[model samples]
Target: MNSEQRMKSEVEIWKRKMMKKSGMMNRITKKAQDKINGLIPEKAHKVITESIKKMVQATLFGSEYLTKPKETYNLSLEEKEALIKDSLNKFRKTAVVEGAGTGAGGLLLGLADFPLLLSIKMKFLFEVASIHGYDVKAYEERLFILYVFQLAFSSEEHKKNVLETISHWDEVKGELVDVDWQVLQQEYRDYIDFVKMLQLVPGIGAIVGAYANYNLLDQLGETAINAYRIRAFNRNEITEEIPLDSDK
Candidate 1:
């Protein structure tokens, strides 16, 4: 198979993984996360959800200034992805540097990494959309970016649902008018809570922060690439069949 065909095969594998059932470790994690969440006050949850909602909205609407001019419309999938790889590398470095700097500052600066890393992730997604020949300026495309974010960090069950939406994005895009901000914030926070907590440590914070941010960007890069790949296939009427079994 050629490069594009190979990429399609890889996307197939990713789709199956996305739809696969949560493993033992995942269940354990979810159980712990749920218990911890239950201990937190409802008011605190509301505040956090609202804060995340506002932060995301501000970033989404204000990110146009951060986007580069699109020049990938004429490029093939392989070529566009080559550009995306370059973009991913650039963002990964930025995330790592920011993570280390903030982590070194202990609790105060470690807290700052949340918004900083979030902006970096969203900005990278915007650029990826551009690379895939999509208009990030459009409302639906921006919403799609949020779904991509959710898919990367949500629980197994939620991830499957988001994957289904993404795989058939064109058909379902009209129905998705707004995001479930509470779910978004909760899932994202729970997903990274442990590592981020470690990033507040006095001595090891720098190393943990740098490592966590690098891996997070790596995960985001994979998700963004395949999410757009699924869209590409959908547009061409070549979408793959994702397994629906709930068992690993």
Candidate 2:
């Protein structure tokens, strides 16, 4: 197989793994998280959910004003991915520094890290979407970014569902009327609660925060790449191997 074919094969394998049934450990964790979520007051859940919803919406709507102009040059998949890797590294360092700084500040700054980190993640997604040749200025492209974010931090069951939608994004994206804010916020919160809770603790918060943020960025980067790969192939943008010299 040629390079594009090989990459397509890898993406298919990743999708299969992503869609697989949750293992015992995952089930156990989900059960525990569910119980914890159950104990929280409904009002509290609503407040948190709405907060995240608005935060994300604000970021999405305002990002166009802040982002660099969309890249217009046609690039082969491999060339596009090289640019993505460099962008990921830059964003990862920003996340790590932000995590460590806030974590070292104890309760107040640690609590502040939520919205801050959320912004960083969203910004990175916007950049990734741009690199993948999607215009985030378009509403549908913005929705795709949200799906990628959800896929990165959601439960296994949710991941499977999101993967299906992403796999058929061309058909599905047009039909997507709105996001389910409750599921988006709850799944994201539950996925990070355990580790992030530790980051709120005073003594080791810095170390925990830095480590958590680094890994989180790494996960986001991988998810964004594969998510775009699914779209790229679907659009026939990467149907054949193209030499690097032809990228210009």
Candidate 3:
């Protein structure tokens, strides 16, 4: 079989191996704990806090792109279909407005993050780029929205333009409140990385993430698979390593 098929088959195998439910939950819980701890420092607070905030912003944008409007709200079949069609259109529009090609600038920093990316520590850059599932030019526009949410812009025009673009994205983004995020704390890190992996495998979709996650859980004993997956993605440490915020 070809490399892609081989890898896909291997993933399928891994899923089958990790099929136990309780074992998977334990692994997920452990992974969540580790991620939360990794998000903060054992003793220091300030630097890790800032870093956590930054990662949260990235993760938020990463996950927000996946959620949909509540279906519990009453709607006629016509309304539901309209909503589905509209959501599809919005994504297409997003693909266009944000740019589907490497150049569309979709919703990303347009051309700005490129230089900014160069200026920052390379490892963080890779991590951030991995937030796009290791696809930079392809997802530049979408990544731009995450940057807008987390960083300071040089000009008001840039900020306003980004805000407008975000405003125009009619599909549901994320939960309305912080508490909503708390509801899924156990899957937080996994979910964040799951979104990135979903971007990597476009056809997999959110349902696939769950399937993959649960499948992996059964196979890999419930721990988060991000570290392993990142390795699989071949994300490398920068040659001239940045001191990872010097707080870890």
Candidate 4:
């Protein structure tokens, strides 16, 4: 296959992976995650929720500290991906350092990691959007970032719903109401609780924090790449023959 065809094939593979049905293990895990969430103190949950809400809002509304959107109209898919990979590497290192520092600092710094890592994640998302040729200054583009965030960190059931929404975003974006931040925050918290809770432990928090943050950024990077690829494919910007199985 030629370069464009190869790119299209890669995107199709990603689409199939994204659409794959959740298995029994996924259901059981969600249940277990929910149970763990229940065991957390109510005050702790409230604190996390409020912190996430504020961080997300600030990022969405154009925090000056975040990366400005780059002009990407002339860049090819390969070029954009190269730039995105570079950004991902930089952010991954930053996360690892932040995690390690906080992890070693005990409970207070562990608590502080929540908002700090969140800011890093959000900043990376905005950069990814710009690299993919989307203007983050637009309100719709910001909402698209939130959808991508949800896709990365939500439960299987919610993932399915978000995938559907993103798949038809061009049609529904205009009619959509504001996102329910409460639900979004809860889903994100539950998804990450197990890994993040481990980051709060005294002895292993540093290792756990670094490892978890690195992997979390990696996961988010993959999700952001594929999400933009889906949009490009749907818009015929990257033309390739659809696989026979795509209609199934």
Q: Which candidate is the best by lDDT?
A: 1
- How good is model 3 by TM-score? 0.24
Give all candidate RMSDs, comma-separated.
2.9, 6.1, 20.8, 2.8
TM-score of each: 0.87, 0.85, 0.24, 0.87
Candidate 1 per-residue C-alpha lDDT over 26-84 given as tens digits, one digit per residue, 9 for 90 to 100: 77876776776666556545644665787668646655424654877788888888899
Question: Which stretches of model 2 miss by more than 4 angstroms?
Answer: 27-51, 64-69, 237-248
The C-alpha lDDT values of all candidates are: 0.81, 0.78, 0.32, 0.80
lDDT of 2 by residue, 75-131 (tens): 788888888899989989999999999899986787677777887888888888777
User: Roughly what TM-score does model 4 have, to 2 decimal places?
Assistant: 0.87
Q: What's the ranking of the predictions by TM-score, best on top?
A: 1, 4, 2, 3
Residue pairs with clashing backbones, model 1: none
| Cα error of candidate 3 at position 54, Å | 5.3
RMSD of 1: 2.9
What lDDT is reached at residue 118 by model 4? 87
For model 4 the local lDDT of residue 247 reads: 36
Candidate achieving higher TM-score, 1 or 2: 1
